[model samples]
Target: MYRVWNFINNYSLLLVAGALIALIWANFDTHAYHHFVEYPLWFNDWIGGDFTRWANNYGEGFEKFEVGDVTKVLSVHYLVNDILMAFFFAIAAKEVWEAVILKEGSLRGKKAATPLIATLGGMLGPIAIYVGLAALMGSATFDAISRGWAIPSATDIAFAYLVGRVVFGAGHPAVRFLLLLAIADDAAGLIILAIFYPSGDLAPAWLLVSLGSAVGVFVLFNWLPRMMDRGDQLRPMSSWVRKYLSFWPYLLAGCASWFGFQEAGLHPALGLLPIVPTIPHADRAFGIFSEAEQYLTDLLNQIEHMLKHPVEVVLFFFGLLNAGVEFSSIGTPTWLVLAGLMIGKPLGVTIFGWIAARPLGLGLPSGMRALDLVVVGCVAAIGFTVSLFIASVAFDGNVVLNGIHVQDAAKMGALFSFAAAAVSIVVGKLLRVEKQHG
Candidate 1:
């Protein structure tokens, strides 16, 4: 029991494991598991699994945020992405800036395949999965949400790190590269989201305004140090001007940028493109303000960290909450989606990686084999967060209202994908372990 606790805690893999457990409990009833499973978390009739019921309840119960005739209660999904996921993107931006741009050799330091190859592999994985699913399902259902192309593009660093720790022990460099690759891949995913997932209703006027705001933010970031230097030379009546002007105004402006992009109907996550530049460096000394501004920066950092995980957690729960697959519902389509993730993902990612590597003359990392590539590909298929978000945006609940429920169908496909990936990892590990012994 202690060992199990340790495994869950150390790996951070508990999120996924817990999600799978919740999904199974929701869908199935073992006496013990059912007794242990908590229902309160998912008990809201107004917001539970039934979309039509939730919609009906909203019309009857509330009267707020009425846009024309579309008066519905706020979607948790919308709240999570628009408000919560903006912070997720902010944190991700910080990490990517640190890893790829600021940190030395963080991404470029590796002797293995170029950052370009890994980034491409990250992209090609999902596209392959989608195309294969479309072909197998005899419909373009998967392609409807081109927004979801990035869903399979990002790997969960925590899960990948846990696997690394378990198989290779702590402080392994290979794991570090794997984590870095995942981070770069996530940044790439963010770029794709900003570019692809717009609602297609363009106000060229607002887009120009957003672009201007972005330019202003960039100019502010560049001009800040010069402004501070000038302020120092002027030796203001109140020294606080340097700090207050430097910190709080920028923070407010940065937050306003979040509001701006959100209003522009782009994914709010794109807001980070402007604000990240405005944040003061931790290493920089802000000598003027009353230490409050410094504290605020720290606070912002902490908030940023906390916000990053919830978007992920919400998706994890949504996956679990909806993963309640009726075993009786199992059929050819089920198997096809399952096979797409299990067989299609690794196959696509590895082949793409291999193609990107050989003739391009980008060699694989030392001690990294085709099998390791396969396992990495499997890990890539664990698309809980982005996949669901994409499904919501792409289908806009149209698929759910249509005969097939969108959330349920996505969860089913994701669960099968996750299961296949998990099995692949376990098998890959066992094979590696056996080879070491032999």
Candidate 2:
């Protein structure tokens, strides 16, 4: 049982399995796959009813559900991407906060300056290439396709980190650099999703309320620990109250913020981000999962540990729901995504790293050469999971605007990350990256 759990816990393996199952299952029985994902579990009458009739009777602003309508049925895709994926983003945001803001993190000072700059280049490079391709294509659908520019910008950290370890061996400085770069990419992607992918008119009041809720959680997290340590009795609670109840504030804050973002017309995946930095975290000096470190009972770490396996399960459903696009639908947008990830990823990372190292006066870590950085950039092109998520956001149910059927095209392109991985392996071999033998 222990060994089985450990094997399933291998993120790279699980992600790959989920993706392969989606691809193969979709191709084999497209109708069955679609039927499974689109099957409604609840609120069938309201959702399946005529939109025109509802809008005419209820008028504008009526589409937004009231508290009573909270139980509306949603498809498998909606549940996975909108609700379950919030936790995934929460974990990613937690890692980003630890790396960038924590005193002992890699980006704390000048030590991480080069990789930070490289991360920026990595993000912008893909966007530039993607948008540039869209412009050059001069197709009528360019505007619709370009909305997905941020899709290829993300670096699937789990895939990149795992492949880097295998290709470059453990303990390599380049692997560390890629990890930081990928974390930064996640931060950038989250910001883009919040700013660019709003579903309705912006509601500033709700957004403010959401931020206020996060602030309240932050205050509670900081104050509760100290109050407990001092043994100050509040409502006759004991020390165990502080130990077990510390996580509730985060949960409440997350829920409140999710509602706020939903009301504010923004993607709710970002709801937990504002609170992550405020949550108490242990000093990850030895790394997040180091068994050697003593247990510190950090709130964020505890949350992450509890949620890891569940998030993996969510990722599997995410793949099953979104990755089953028809191969015949592959088109220009699909090619654009593939090219951006495969060609632009390496080009951007290497060029940006050179600029940072030479003109920006940031030095690369010892034993890490410029060519090695290029290889690392190639590995960074594996933007599978998040790319798919963004594709769904960019094109699904949005046919009136894009006019071009981009959901399948974009998803097909996301699956091309497998090809990108193959390219990375070839590039690594050509660059003579040493392979570790157990």
In model 1, which range of ten residues has the least summed lDDT? 1-10
Candidate 2, 1-438: lDDT as tens digits = 001123123666667677788888878987677667655444533322223333332333445544244434455655677778899899788777877766888667887888888888888888888999898977666766878888888888778876777677766778778877887888888988899887456886889878898888766666565555675555333345446776787788888888788678788767777777777777763443344233557777777768878888888788777887777777888888888888888888999888888888888887687888888889999888889888887874434323445878887888887676677788888988865432
TM-score of each: 0.69, 0.86
The TM-score of predicted model 1 comes to: 0.69
> Per-residue lDDT tens digits of candidate 1, residues 91-143?
55765664544434355454535534754665675566655655554455544
State the displacement of the C-alpha of residue 97, model 1, in Å, after optimal TM-score superposition. Answer: 2.2
Model 1: runs farther than 4 Å from truth? 1-75, 103-105, 109-115, 139-150, 217-222, 230-251, 282-340, 356-358, 400-402, 433-438
The prediction achieving the highest lDDT against the true structure is: 2
- Candidates in order have lDDT scores of 0.50, 0.74
Cα distance off (Å), candidate 2, residue 312: 1.2
Clashing residue pairs found in predicted model 1: 105-109
Error (Å) of candidate 2 at residue 379 is 0.3
